[model samples]
Target: MTFLKKHKNDILLILAVLILAGGFWLYSSFAMDKGGEAVISVDGKELCRLPLGVDTTYTIGEGEHFNSLVISGGEAWMADASCPDHICVNSGKVSLEGQSIVCLPNKTIVSIVGGEDSGLDGVAG
Candidate 1:
C-alpha cells in the first residue's frame, strides 16, 4: 500500500506520456491531407501539368532520330528512350518531393516538385 501511494503520480505521468505519443503518431499519419497536384518544371518555371486519365509522349530532343518518352497519370517517369543505359526508364513513378526521372542522353529531367500551396515557408507561417 505504501509503495502504491508513493508511485501513483509516476505511473499516471508515464501513462499520459504514452497516450500523447500515440495520438501524435495517428494524427501525422492519417489526419493530414497531403494529396496535391503534380508539377514538372525546369529552372524554377512550370513546364507541364499532368492530371489524371491523361498522358503525353514527349520527344527528348531536336534531331529527326531523337528518342521519345511519355508521362502519364500525374506521374512523369521515363517511359522509353534510346540511351545505352535504361536506368532512368526503370526509375519508376515518383509522387513525392525530390523524386525525379531523368534521361541522361537527352539532358531531360522529369522531377516532382511540391504543389502550389505546399512549401516549407508557407507551412511554417
Candidate 2:
C-alpha cells in the first residue's frame, strides 16, 4: 500500500503511455486506405500498373530473368521468381499505399500506389 502511494505518479505515466501506444497502433493498422494500383518497375523504369480490383498474374522480364506477380482479392504479391533467394516471393501481399516488395537480384520492384489521401505530408523512417 505504501509502495503504491509512493509510485502513484509513475504508475499513472506508464498507463498513459500504454494507452497512447495502443491507440496509435489501432489507427495505423485500421486507418490505411486500400491501394488502387500496383506499379511494377524494373531497373528503376516503370513497366506497368495493374489495378488492384482485377485478379491477374503478370510476368516481368524475359529469358533467364523473370518474376511473376499475382494480384487477387485487392492485394498483390510475388507469386514466383527466377531469383535464387526468392525473398520477394516470400514477402507476402501488399494492399496499402507505399508498401512494396523488392527483388534485388532481378532489379524489380512492385509497389502499391494511388490510394486516397492519408492526411500526412510524408512518412519518415
Candidate 3:
C-alpha cells in the first residue's frame, strides 16, 4: 500500500496509456468493418459513384467500341458482370460485389470498385 501510494502517478499514467491504446484499436476495427464508399473514376477524377447493386451502363463512341464492333442490342454492357471465368458475351456488366468481365480480344477490363471488397480481386486497387 505504501509503494502504491508513492507510485500513484506512474500507475495512473500506465492506465491512461492502456485506455488510449484500446480506444484506438476499437475505432480502427469499426472503420474497417463499415466498408468504405465505392467510387468510379478515371485518372483520379471521380466520374460516378452509384449505390450498391445499381445497374448502369456507360457507352463509348463509334471509334471507342472497336474497328468493326457492332452492338445491335443496345451495344452497351451491364455496368457489371458475374461469371466464374469472367469470359462471357454478357459478362461485361459490373454491378455486384466480386463481379467483373474482361474482353481479352479487345484488351478491355470491366471491374467493380468500392463498398466492402473481399480484398481478393487482383486488378482492383
Candidate 4:
C-alpha cells in the first residue's frame, strides 16, 4: 500500500507512455493505405516496378546472385535471397509507402512508393 502510493505517478506515467506508443503503432498500421508500386533496384539503378494491388513473383538476378521477390495482398517481401546474411529474406512484408527491403551483399533494394492524395477532388467527372 505504501509502495503504491509512493510510486503511483511513475507507474501511471509508464502506462501512459505504453498506451500512446501502442496507439501510434495501431494507427500507422491500419490508417495508412497500401502504396502504389514496388520499385526494385540494383546498385542504385531501378530494375523494375510492380503494382502493390497486383500479385506477382520475380526472380531478381542470375546464377548465385538472385533474390526471389513476391508481391501479394498489397505487400512485398523477399521470399529468398543469395545474400550472405539472408537479412532480406527475413525482412517480412513491406506495404506502407517508402518501406524497403535491402540486400547489401546482392546490392538489391525493393522499395514501396506512392499513397499521396495528389490534391485532386475525390469525385470524378
Candidate 5:
C-alpha cells in the first residue's frame, strides 16, 4: 500500500502512455485506405498498374536486368531480381496504400496506388 502511494505518479504516467499507444495502434490499423492496384515504374517512368485482386507474376525489364514481381492474395512483392543486393526482393510484401518496394540499382519501383489520397504533396525539410 505504501509502495503504491509512493509510485502513484509513475503508474499514472505509464498508464497514460499505454493508453495513447493503444489508441494510435488502433487508429493506424483501422484507418487508411487499402490500395487496389500495384503500380510499377522504372527510371521515374510509369510502367504498368496491376490489379491486386489478380494473382500473377510480372517481369519488368529484360536481358540481364530484370525484376520479377508477384501479386497474390491482395499483396505485392518482389519475387526475384537481377540486382546484386536483392534488397527489393527481401523487403517482403506490401498491401497498404503508399507502400513501395524500390531497387536502386535496377532503377525499379513498385508502389501501391488507387487508394484515398492523404492530401500531402512532398514534405519539406
Candidate 6:
C-alpha cells in the first residue's frame, strides 16, 4: 500500500521496539528461580526454608508479635501479622531470588532465594 510505503521506516522502528521489549520480558521471566525456596528469619536468625512451588502456611515470631506466612502458586507473602504497621502483610507476594517481605516490628524477614539462583556468595549493588 502507498501509506505503508510512505511510513515504512516508522513501522520498522515500532516493530524493532516490540521485538526488543518481548525479548527482555522473556529473559527476565526465565531468569527467575521458579523452584526457589523462601527463607524465613526472625531477629537475624534463620527460621525455616519453604519451597515456593509448594503451598504451605507457617507462623513466625512469638505471642502478640506473630506473623503468618503463606506460600502458594509459586509465590510467598505474609497473609497475617500482629505488627502495628502491617507493612509485611501489605508487601505483595514474591517468587524471585533476592525478593523479600520484611517485618521490622516483628524482626521477621521472608526472602525468595536458592534452588536455581545464580551463584554468588553475596553481592552489593
For residues 70-103, what per-residue lDDT tens digits would candidate 2 score against the true structure? 9988889999999999999999999887789999
lDDT of each: 0.59, 0.87, 0.43, 0.85, 0.87, 0.83
Candidate 1 residue spans exceeding 4 A from truth: 1-54, 64-67, 117-125
Q: Residue 28, candidate 6: how far off, in angstroms?
A: 8.4
Residue 43 lDDT (model 6)? 88
lDDT of 6 at 46: 93
What would the per-residue lDDT of candidate 3 be over residues 27-123, giving only the tens digit for each residue? 7555443222234343334544444333234432234342111222312243322323335455543344334445554444434444543342335
**Candidate 6 local lDDT, 14-56, one digit each (tens):** 9999999999888878886653789999989999888776689
Model 6, global lDDT: 0.83
Query: lDDT by residue for model 4 over 24-82, one digit each (tens)?
Result: 98887787655778899999999888887678999999899999999888788999888
Clashing residue pairs in candidate 3, if any?
A: 79-94, 80-93, 80-94, 80-95, 81-93, 81-94
- After superposition, the stretches of candidate 4 with alpha carbons farther than 4 Å from their true spots are 1-33, 115-125
Query: Could you tell me the lDDT of residue 37 within candidate 5?
Result: 84
What are the per-residue Cα lDDT tens digits for candidate 5 across 26-50?
A: 8866875677789999999999989
> Model 3, which residues run further than 4 Å from truth?
1-55, 64-88, 92-94, 116-125
**Residue 9 accuracy (lDDT) in model 5:** 100
Ranking by TM-score: 2, 5, 4, 6, 1, 3
What does candidate 1's lDDT look like per residue over 1-125, in tens digits? 99989999998999999999999877655654432344544445566655422467666555532445565654556666667787777887665554567756655566555565345335757
Between prediction 1 and prediction 2, which has the larger TM-score?
2
| Models, CA RMSD each | 11.6, 8.7, 15.4, 5.1, 9.2, 9.2
For candidate 6, list the clashing residue pairs, or say none: none
